[model samples]
Target chain A: DAGITQSPRYKITETGRQVTLMCHQTWSHSYMFWYRQDLGHGLRLIYYSAAADITDKGEVPDGYVVSRSKTENFPLTLESATRSQTSVYFCASFNRESYNSPLHFGNGTRLTVT
Target chain B: QKEVEQDPGPLSVPEGAIVSLNCTYSNSAFQYFMWYRQYSRKGPELLMYTYSSGNKEDGRFTAQVDKSSKYISLFIRDSQPSDSATYLCAMRDSFANAGGTSYGKLTFGQGTILTVHP
Candidate 1:
């Protein structure tokens, strides 16, 4: 029961609507990341947080906002959803204490914007 | 060119056959390499990892990295039906002090899907 979890495993939103995907982990990992997976692109990082209140943009962060008020939670918000935003989103965490620590990922949330 | 490139393959193989998966990267700074296995509708799990250019074997799985050619490979011996899943290759630079923080960010390749039939 101490794994990562994402709410509303599936989501559908109309174009221009605002949507927020929630991610929570019980491991208290210091590094949390958000990535979007599409057909041709494997997994592109949208945003990542090194710790609570410390966030950075990733490869593709446009139109997306992320916040980490607490160490166990990192949520991603789409200000104005577009059809291009329709893809599977994954939340991952890694312990920074070890150099070789592997990233642990949540089940993922499938979002569709029409 | 992308930082990492992999063939998005829906490769099929009979059980007990050997399977090979590979990826190429354009970044020469990447020193840590890894492979992850992802099942349908599930998140990827780390399968193997190697630091620098070398080969590491674990049971039926083997991971090889060639920094000279900027290529990496994963070999599966005696593949089974359970091996039917997507394999992802990921790499990251060893420099962790760019901004005084641990730069553990990873660049991932497009996963390769493999199906081993019984």
Candidate 2:
């Protein structure tokens, strides 16, 4: 119960459709990140938020938008889904104040765009 | 080339066997290294971590980092069937970025899938 959770473990959307994945953490970690895992590219960060209302782009942020309105929630939205967007998306949280805190990840949401 | 590189092996080993996993990185700024175990359909969990260049062991798992060679490894002794899963190597530059952003971000290697058989 004291972990990160992602909604809709699996999702399928048509090309050009909009999709959003929700992420929630119970620990109230200050840093929340969104990563996409593909066949050859391990895990590439899409976006991250240092705190509520503070967000930044990561390695691959194109076509994606993120908002952290609350400390416990960070949501990712795909403006127009493409077939290339089909991959497993993971949400993770880290405690910025804890020097040795390891990132905690939520069960990924598998999204397929066709 | 990618900052981190791993073989992405679907390695198979019999129970009780010794298993080795490795990753090479191009970034010299990385100071903290970590290993994560991910089971099928599950999120990855941190298994071990080491600071700078050194070795750290816990139970049957050992993590080794050689900053000079820009290589890191994970060894599992007496591997069990339950050990079957994908192991990921991750590293980050623990220092603050000059751009005023937190350098707590990690770069991950393509995970190696391992199977321990009975």
Candidate 3:
């Protein structure tokens, strides 16, 4: 019951439309991360939050926005979706202070922009 | 060059054979190396981790890291059909996310697909 969950396990949006993917965790982990997985690019970090109300951009943050108003939720928004934005998005959480803490991930939300 | 690189192989092997997956990185600052196994359409799950340059064994999985050469490897003994998946190599500077100068970010490889056939 204490696990990460991503909503809309799959999504489809038209280009120029706004889409928001939801991520929630019952574990109350301090660090939350959002990453997009592409065909040839593996997983690239889009954004991460250290705690409530604290968020930072990741390796490829363009066109994406995230906010952590509460420790349980970290949502990623695409201001304007594009065809290139079609990919699987994963949400992960961890207690980073502990070096051995492995990131716990959600099932993921697959988004496709046409 | 990418911080981490891995051979994206659909490496086919007979069941019970030993399977080796590897990754190379250019960053000498990476102090923690991890291997993740991801089944198709599933998010990667951490398989094993090594804090320093050494080997750690867990059941059928073994992880080895060599800091001097910036190479890391994961070996699966007695590979099985259930072991088939994309193995991703991830590294992090454990100190980055602390209050000091790092952010504890993770750099992951492209992933290698492995299949154990009967």
Clashing pairs in 2: none
Cα lDDT tens digits, model 3, A44-108, are 99999888998888899999999889999999999999999999999999976677888888889
TM-score for model 2? Answer: 0.97
Cα displacement (Å) at residue A89, model 3:
0.2
Summarize candidate 1's per-residue lDDT along B3-115 as a digit string, tens digits: 89999988999999999999999988889999999999999999999999999999999999999999999999999999999999999988553344547789999999999
lDDT by residue for model 2 (A64-95), tens:
99999999999999999999999999999998
- Tens-digit lDDT string for candidate 1 (A45-93): 9999999999999999999999999999999999999999999999999
Model 3 whole-model lDDT (C-alpha atoms): 0.91
Complex DockQ, candidate 3: 0.68
List iRMS (one decimal) for every candidate. 1.1, 1.1, 1.7
What are the per-model DockQ values? 0.75, 0.76, 0.68
Docking class of 2: medium
> TM-score for every candidate vs. truth?
0.97, 0.97, 0.96
Error of 3 at A80 (Å): 0.8
Using lDDT as the measure, name the better of candidate 1 and candidate 3: 1
